[model samples]
Target chain A: MKIRALALALGVAASGAVSAAGEVEVLHWWTSGGEAAALNVLKDDLSSKGVSWADMPVAGGGGESAMTVLRARVTSNNAPTAAQMLGYDILDWGKQGAAADLNAVAAKEGWDAVVPAALQNFAKHDGKWISAPVNVHSTNWVWANKAIFDELGLSAPINFDELVATLEAIKKAGYTPLAHGGQAWQEATIFDSVVLATGGVGFYRKALVDLDADALGSDTMKTVFDRMAILRSYVDDNFSGRDWNLASAMVIEKKAGMQIMGDWAKGEFLNAGQKPGDDFMCFRFPGTSGAVTFNSDQFMMFKVGSDRRDAQNQLASSIMAPSFQSAFNVVKGSVPARTDVSDADFDACGKKGMRDLASANANNTLLGSLAHGHAAPASVKNAMYDVITAHFNGEYSSADAVSELVAAVDAAK
Target chain B: MSQKWWQQQLPKLVLSPSFALVLFFVYGFILYTGYLSFTDSRMFPSNELVGFANYEKLFALRHWKIAITNLGIFGGLYIGICLVLGLMLAIFLDQKIRGEGVLRPIYLYPMALSFIVTGTAWKWFLDPGIGVEQIVQSWGYTDFEFRWIKDRTMAIYCIVIAGVWQTSGFVMAMFLAGLRGIDGEIMKAARVDGASSVQLYRRIIIPMLRPIFLSAFVVLAHMAIKSYDLVIALTNGGPGRATELPATFMYSYTFTRNQMGVGATSAMVMLMTIAAIIVPYLYSELKGSKKS
Candidate 1:
């Protein structure tokens, strides 16, 4: 009888231990220095909460390969507990019933109030929250070496004409005016800046967001193409095939005048021991200061069986918690998705991003970054990639490129 | 009677695991992918039927056009150059010259490398700034430009060059085997008739390599149809979609673009094309063999 009682006690202990050690596998493409650093906050928090993290990182900028792995796992009924998703993917996957409905967890944590409206829209399917947004990335920022500008007696260009003159001046001084990476994504980033710079914020919304045919073929788009032709002159001859971080390195070393990239380039600068405002400057590309092109990285929880759902809820609550938002974004080199989160630990550039994000959110200047998977379907995005890259390589005439772009969108539809 | 039945079925039972693997991994996956082509799936498999909508997009994209065009250019050049060069190398090596053993190993070593490693080395050698162009410029041949990999029209040929470097050795080995199989009496007659080296090879030996030629043709054609890794690693279908192949196009559509339906359709199209060519040729070869 005593032995039977001991076995029952041990059974209870084993069941309790099992409940405490639920392991969650997270799949993401955040292998870069800053990205990994940011991911550690969540890892550390999860560990502190007695949850184990099985980290699966796939190294690719595009995140397509990781999505492939995620889909395969889901199809095999072995999906990861959570995965990194972007833009419409939350809705896209949620609609397919691949994502777990986080409504109960969200209500318990009051996630609706903390998370931004735009992000919540993307994260929800039929008003049910399915994903947790991590941070906001603004894609139209132009990073410049402050030392180069100071040494050359130049200031940040505030308009299209001034920006052109600045680029010309930088070139005449024998420095490459643009430290541009020649990847398709980087080229598209430059194009996004061009569109906003030439056409202003409203046109970007109409053409890119709404996919308005007349807006796409407007004289505004022609101006954008023309400016791209000019911007081409600022890049070095051997810019093709250069990685984005390498381009950032050029700016960090003051070898080139500027690089038009997303806010993520700040991480590269920070890694090089360069502080913002002292060594470099971040500003929206000249004529695009009033516009904000944005893409977000969100962590989406998948539907596991009931036993692990509680652990998933705990992580979701931690993600939306104010403390985690601040800590994660400070390391991530991005602004926290929560507007109310403190930017105390943020650097000068990050603080600027926070201020800009708030203002953009308030003023309705937030445009989605198409190439980075916010504005269009993947088919339309890839079609645009082909035409834009072809045009950049000088293989297509402006007229030819415009026609192809329109045709590609129609075909994509 | 039961023991006899067990013994009769033992070999089949023992090999069942491998047969099951082949059925599932090869044929089952192929059918699954074909079924996926008919659906309007994105990010995850959806049962929404969109019936050839994806294929319509694949054909409409300019990058797809460039990929199909590049396949033709690279496929023809790679096979033609590798076959001719491999035959010449095999013939020369068969002369029983000194150091033949060492040279043969050297030729075959390239076939052992992963395309990723080979592509990196090739990219460095072909880079406009750091490669042949730089070396020539340093040597005061300022006008000597080797920028074929950078040139949009000629980038596909650059992939062909890399392909020959990798595969010519294998082809040489095949031709070498074919050459060794020739009867000694034919060479004796050729020498007695005072046939030159070129005349003997062109007239007699070339005709004798018919079976080897057919085998090599099929192997090369299969390689061309499924070429992906080399293009991905080397040019990444770049210089603005100038060096894309059908396989890479299918990969990007299925994986990168998340347009699985389109990707699946392209795969089916590629499979059908291969079937159309290979089925008839294989049938004719089998018939010819039977007649012999």
Candidate 2:
């Protein structure tokens, strides 16, 4: 019934043009406040090119449910034109040869020169472009309330020691030093960044990304767990089941000093009409500023009939275009996927993200985020999440947690 | 003879489609799920058989243990509370009370709402920052606190509370029906014997409602095992897997985490758990009927 209603509405909106040209039916889970606005950029871009978009917006936060729907649709041989996928999920679909060959669009757009290699790796399957890169979201970011920071005469922490000191001072000032949500994914988000901060980018990759037993069970990993415990201690009793945005709201209201979250939390600040660098300060999670943990949101085009292939091409071109990339990522609270896109209108935090991303890219320090499905497969990442969150919740000691991580990753592998 | 045969065949013909649907979709799928439990499936189903490897892994995970522990806590509390409440309400309404017709519907109304709705409403009502805690604090009781939904140790109780709220009324209706079916002559005789109202219930009425209790237990036990949406909306097995149940674990593993084998194993375990409760009850029911 909902599908019929949507089709009827699309038919009315299209009138004669849909049959004249082709329609792009994009399946995604970008229905939140800021996410919706950002998605309109891609929609309007396609519309400007005489292509119609049949919006199939599934409104799950993490797109996990959307992937289930997509899998069923594909198995039924009625795949959508495109779907919003992350990291190896795109590759997973590509391995099935379910995604389209977008080399036609890629060659025309000079994507090889423009799109980042890291994003391109997942977008390509067997050396063929199957998806279009949209934006880069670095997960290891700390959003601090500038008001609280200034009142306390503190700067953003430069290391784990400094971060602890800053948090202690924030606690002394009688504030939630670290605003946190108690969900598994939220806990893993903090752990992902903490992995980078505790060890350098190399250690983060070896342990989290590669599931290395030596790195996972080492004393360094134990200290990472210790730091995680310290971070957990800073949260209040009311923190469980709290939405990530609400945690961001704590920083927005100056009730909390800092939030360890992805760049997407900027949307909450933006929604609250708070400007970055003025109302808040954005930095890489302490000791990890030099590196970036990235997860790119890519739209994988599916194999549609010849009739709608033109619309798919139009979508690919529009999405890959520098102007739309800038416009979309600006609203999407992510940096542009294109390295060459100008950061002129980007906010202070956005500029920092762009600069850090470029430097990380140059220095080979850009690692994919585990919580957001960039570093490992879903099974391995979820295993790590179980261990990480269980440890974070005090189900295991730091050493036990480290050993459990090794066992979990090994079992999943 | 032809006319009689045609009339008899018509009912079977009318029911065949639904019966076939139930057989193939329900029972057939169960067998298929059983098969998948033994295979090495992930992200998508596969043909590779791994014997009981998935089940072994599923049992070893700490999260799975936590999920089972939560189920025990939730299921026990949910069933115990609902049964007691339902019995009490049935007794209250059975006393030739005023506006019984009006009151019965009020009691059963919560059963009409989906657990999702019940959960979301209760989530708001129980969450510390925005629910009762915040409301009470705002009312000048600044030290007042209610954070059970957020507390790892107590989060499962919040689910139990919501589950009972949605289901106790249904249990009440079942008991009420059971009460109405009781012979009025027995109650009159008990009254003549100088039995108190409480004694009448304790000695005769309650014991007579055994079948109703059994039926309610089976229903509630199945619901407790399959408690997914309520948990999802209430805590989503969160505050670090504190409220995780087998159903939610099965879903997250199969769909979200792409560990379909472990998920199927969990599903099989849940099916066995539910079957263990229901099969014997069904056998006794059928055997008793046959004996009669």
Candidate 3:
């Protein structure tokens, strides 16, 4: 009986390998509760089209480990059908001729008319579409516990000074003024808004996006560091090594007044069974109202053999479908990548995000976030992380941080 | 004649596949990485040789500097503490104490766990709000403070604490084996010659355990040098890169930061450091064994 079972297993494996025609291997980093559910929407859509999904989840928050695995797979001549990539990384792969051109599918699906230009910049390389963007994650939003603000009789602060005063009020109420994770990326996320608030969108583009030495070393950058220092004082002593979701939980639990993070934090609040407008509130980081610092999640298709090309194209088209984008982004706590998607099914925060994104795109205030690998290349982003984290941790003063920022960016370039 | 040749070549034939695999995968990759270090590689390997520019850039990086400094502090404290603690435990166990078998396994159990588990456990245990500090506070000691893991300057010491906690047990086992291997006759002779317990250990037993000490040092030193997962699990080289080490730096640069050339350069430097330690020890051991 055992011998028979072994023979059957081997025969099944052999047939499985022979029948691996319609399988699409998707490498992604969305393993969190909401994120996993969000990805399932796409998986089910692809599966419905008779294309099997071979899920390759690498669970780093920043998709760093996924990129690492993707590079290894590419180098070994066994690239996945598609890899969930971010800004700059997609173009980097496209430049290396590793990504498969998706212009044929993209044109057929009219993706150019639907997807936002900011996202399209990452989706295309050399006038050919190589990827499909899924969602837009704006990093300048602050999630606050509405109860705490109501009890303290404090409203949302609209500028830097008022924000400081509100934090003081929250501290006086004996709550953690700011819920912040001490990780480098989290610190840099806060810095993204702080830079925008301090110097406006043009200066942010100059200092971070353009890697300008003059803007980076100017007094404006020094003032940005000073404001960062103020934020550092508001964080709790136990903030070190904490994850961003835990920081979000602080606000949700009413132990903290607010947390300055991306829209992804909204997922945490929703996961905790809390309603957005009732239990919590979402607002742009003060003085960053008109500007949206954004990062879009894009799935860059890798060059694969003709046997799997049809399935890969199916996956690309499914990712760009308006229905799939709305369904996925509603659960993902991010706005849909497609501009034509309706906000009727979205909750309060989601609707606001859609409105803000549309307005920001029209006004050309939609800047790529430096913290989220959209403003610059990975090298420059990491360099900025080093300086910003150091400054936030009080290792460097405002003056030292400005000079170090300029030097670090230059060295990275 | 054919049967005789087959028998003579059996061991060589059996070992050749593994030997070839090791040579290609280990040494071949090492040489490849060394070559990549000289090139202008980023995100992926490239053949454009930039010659020593990556090395210059690496040395000038503040992150690299902090990583090196942290390695020194972490490696020194981890190895030193483990040695002292391991020696004490082994000597204590060497005494004809009751339940030696039970105590031995209890101490050695930590060694069975991966550094990742040890690091995570220690991270929670050392965290201020959740672990020791809270536990102490709940015990009515509100003024108690044990937040070293959260502090910038003192976070590296927390890594040393966790690393020593995990590895000292294995080192203790090594020392205990060495102690058991010591000839009973020499110990008896020393005792009969009016040697006290302290003198017996300090002057005779410890002097004879020099080889064990050397072995333990070599083992602990390499573990300290390549400690990536432990640092990652504990502080993640954070609280502002205060606990960054070379291994973590190499990984972040090569994979995450898109600075593969600098990463390879860091890796080569680390390899040289390990070689600087291990080559001399290996030569001495081989020479000493040959003489014996």
Candidate 4:
């Protein structure tokens, strides 16, 4: 309690350093063309506010390498003004007092009224807002080549039966049934969709979020593994070690029938000059229509010094502004974290995402994505990643995998 | 007398900073990592002691087991194949063939490139879709299969193939240098004795090349143990950790999985392994060299 008070006092003192000279050095992993374009919107916005943007991009997908860089920089006491962090990672940094207090800006901007409570849970730590939520990314998506599906005379699968039939029919038509990269994280991405689809949202919460042993060991979980086995069979022989973008390229070239990826895959199609409904189509992975597994990309300011607080405030407000949120998420291929934002500027896919996110929010089917470091801490998530990948690679049977996951998560917790 | 004593101590004083740096960075970090293994450190280090719990977990992990097993397969094949290929290349180059200079450079060019370059080039060259299989099928043979990088059982061999392609050329140069160091008078004497070429090599040349063989073996073993990048570039330990090496495993656990303790334990085990292969060879080499 005393530590919290001291932190708040330090935070107040830091906020007083918001002066006229606004030079912000931002560290992030937004190096892809579309992501970079989206990042420019924020840069321009901050520039209008008289702040200079010093870009520090560490290029690696999934932001793992960027986190390593962040850790080293913080240890060296040269923390940047802002960094792109995922859900629990922000909380982890906040716990270590690496993040600066943003409650001053957060309160003035009515963040509590605008930002979803789910995002606020990560944005704030110990009743203090430390990070700004930028955009929401949901994992349960299956992007398909519209031409292949039209030629096959099919639509998006609505359930497990339909999904199997769709994939089988696509295989019979002599196309790669699934465009997939066989990396551990990619495999786990598909696994996350399968778990959400097979077991209901409640089961996903219990098994992934709560790390319940009984839920992990259940036959429902086994069924998910069975589906994963089928999905694994759909990938081509050259899928191993292929980049996620290359897999998307196969779909783009109409060589593959479908891809089970997050909304970020939308950016790849856009980069390829493909329209959403005409060139490709997307849907909630079968049997997970009303449910959503989401992760937000948040920008967190470090405790660099009191001098950079104004630039930090400018960045925080720019990211949360409804105008900036829509413009950014449109290019970045995610929905806005603020419900107040209008989806008028979005495409068919983005509009669908917004509607589904609303319905999922109302129905309480919205859950943090387990595979993307939102639902659970890194230790538990990585443990599950190991078990999931091992099973996918035929290292363990589904039965043994279930037991292994239980033990792994327990040890990690 | 004081000036003379100061001169004697100058070298030690000049080297003290670097010596202390080595002590703190190399040996000090190793001891720190060793200490970290005994704690329950995760994502960040902590002082909370857990006694051999991390080691226990590291051994129990299925991923670590696969990584160790892969190291055994990778190390054995990488060392044995590189040595044989290197020896054959060196012998062939020593035949005084025309354009030996050009051929030597051609064979040694791969050594000039890094392991990363070798792995990537091999990754494309051996890929079924865009590489050898595609080229073969384009020649009107439809059913060509060269998808070892994609197969779970054969992925480690892809790493092996790339590693050999990168290091064997260097090894050839080592053996070639050794062969050049041999006395031509002995060859003339053996020829006068009516000794066959095969017999001469088996009796004299092979035995005389023993020290070079030991040196090559030590170097290759060390390279095999520390091989992380080649495997990463070629397979990235994918198809579900099929080509996982000890180094990759240590990295995954320490940085990605937030299991620093387990990662440290894995690092210690790797240190012990490299030591087991190197310490004896090193001791023998140094002690024997000193005696001679």
Candidate with maximal lDDT: 3
Candidate 2 CAPRI grade: medium
Q: Number of clashes in every candidate structure?
A: 0, 0, 0, 0
Q: DockQ scores for all the models shown?
A: 0.63, 0.74, 0.77, 0.71
Q: Worst ten-residue run, lDDT, model 2 chain A?
A: A13-22
* TM-score of each model, in listed order: 0.95, 0.95, 0.96, 0.95
> Ten-residue segment with the worst summed lDDT in candidate 2 chain B?
B145-154
- Model 2 spans > 4 angstroms off: A1-15, A18-21, B135-144, B194-198
- Pairs that collide in candidate 2 are none
> What is the per-residue lDDT of model 2 for residues B183-245, given as tens digits with 9 covering 90 to 100?
999999999999998899899999999999999999999999998999999988877778899
Residue lDDT tens for model 1, B1-292: 6999999999999999999999999999889888898898765666898887777766876667777888889889989998999898999999999999999989988989877777778888898889989998999999998888777787788889889899899899999999999998999999899999889988999999998988888788888889899888888877777788999988888887767788888898889878877898899988999999
Comparing 1 with 3 on lDDT, the higher-scoring candidate is 3
Q: Model 4, residue B227: displacement in angstroms?
A: 0.6
Clashing pairs in 1: none
User: Order of candidates by lDDT, top first?
Assistant: 3, 2, 4, 1
Cα lDDT tens digits, model 4, A1-413, are: 99999988887775533324478899999997788999999988887777788899999988889989988898888999989999888888888888888888878989888776767788899998888888999889999999999998999989988998999999999999999987777888888889888888889889998888999999999988888988888888678778888899999999999988889999899989999999999988999999888999999888867677777888888889999999999889999998889999999999999988877877888889888988899989888888898888788888888999999898788
Question: Could you give the TM-score of chain B for each candidate, in order?
Answer: 0.93, 0.95, 0.98, 0.97
DockQ score of the complex predicted as candidate 1: 0.63
Q: What is the DockQ score of candidate 2, to 2 decimals?
A: 0.74
iRMSD for each candidate structure, in the order shown: 1.6, 1.3, 0.7, 1.4
lDDT value, residue A221 of candidate 4: 92
